[model samples]
Target: MSEQHTYRVIVRGVWDGLSEDSRARLLAEVDDHGLTAMTFSEEGSLTYDRALKHFSWRFTVVSDAADGDEMAAAIAEDRAASALAALGHGFRDLRSTVTDLDTMKINYKGGRR
Candidate 1:
């Protein structure tokens, strides 16, 4: 059986060509999308600052592909785009970075390696 890996993907992009109404709506909902609400979730968590110049989406994905990291990143980026579109938001320079949790080494609190 192929092994599955859990990945945390962060998709980042800049807001582009947002209408005044959309901008106002986002600003009004800032409390819900603020840094305090950020999380790595399968459904994705979107976060941005009050400035609204840039934003990021955090997604938790599980994949069994040999290139799970890349695949997870791609999936997260696409999901982010769809979400932005659904909200009538425009984004540019979308990019994603993924971390494979299975291969990640935890640093011990003690001196143990």
Candidate 2:
């Protein structure tokens, strides 16, 4: 059986200092359907301290159909429009920085899976 895969979603250019209410609403809207998306990667935890101006989301999905990076990029595109609306600046550019899943070292820590 194929293993589950994790996809990291990193977005930049969202203005910092969001109000608690705004942040919560944004979080809910973007993350409520976590089951539809992949799981938050434990590997992505470190991304936060360095990702202040940006935000990260993740999805862990098990699918043999779609290629990982392609799936990740598709999620990025699907969310970009709504995310821009939520941020409400209209002019703030979004910069996505997901490590291509194809090159990700999934099982390299000790040995191949």
Candidate 3:
């Protein structure tokens, strides 16, 4: 079995509403939470200007499935969820949709699940 996993986390909100300092604090908190990798995607300015402006942040946590048990995936997911929640950013648990060997992908959004 392969030994790789991926997870996605979506954060929706006015990215611009957050001050630069707050942004930095959020990023630092994420890092402190120990996520393997994280990426952010922002809609175009026009969309950002819309009433429902929002942004998405994805987190990918890599682990070795072949060397570990299913618990690893659960732990990763729990940790990610806790981390985001700790940052005061809404964190919705989207459970793992894909559970391939060495790969587990979980999705999370800030708003309602």
lDDT of 2 by residue, 46-89 (tens): 12222235444443323333466666645653465465455552
Regions of model 2 farther than 4 Å from truth? 1-4, 14-65, 100-103, 106-113
Q: Write the per-residue lDDT of candidate 1 for residues 1-113, one digit (tens) a residue.
A: 78889999999999999999889999999999997888999999999977989999999998885867878888889899998999999889999989999999998687756
Q: After the best TM-score superposition of candidate 1, give how far the Cα of residue 92 lies from its true spot, in angstroms.
A: 0.7
How many clashes (backbone N, Cα, C below 3 Å) per candidate?
0, 4, 1
> Cα-based RMSD of the predictions, in order?
2.3, 8.6, 13.1
lDDT of 1 at 56: 93
Report the Cα lDDT for candidate 3. 0.41
Badly placed stretches (over 4 Å) of model 1 are 111-113
User: Can you give the lDDT of residue 20 in candidate 3?
Assistant: 58
Candidate 1's error at 58, in angstroms?
0.6
lDDT of each: 0.91, 0.47, 0.41
User: For model 2, what is the error of residue 63's alpha carbon versus the real structure, in angstroms, after optimal superposition?
Assistant: 6.7
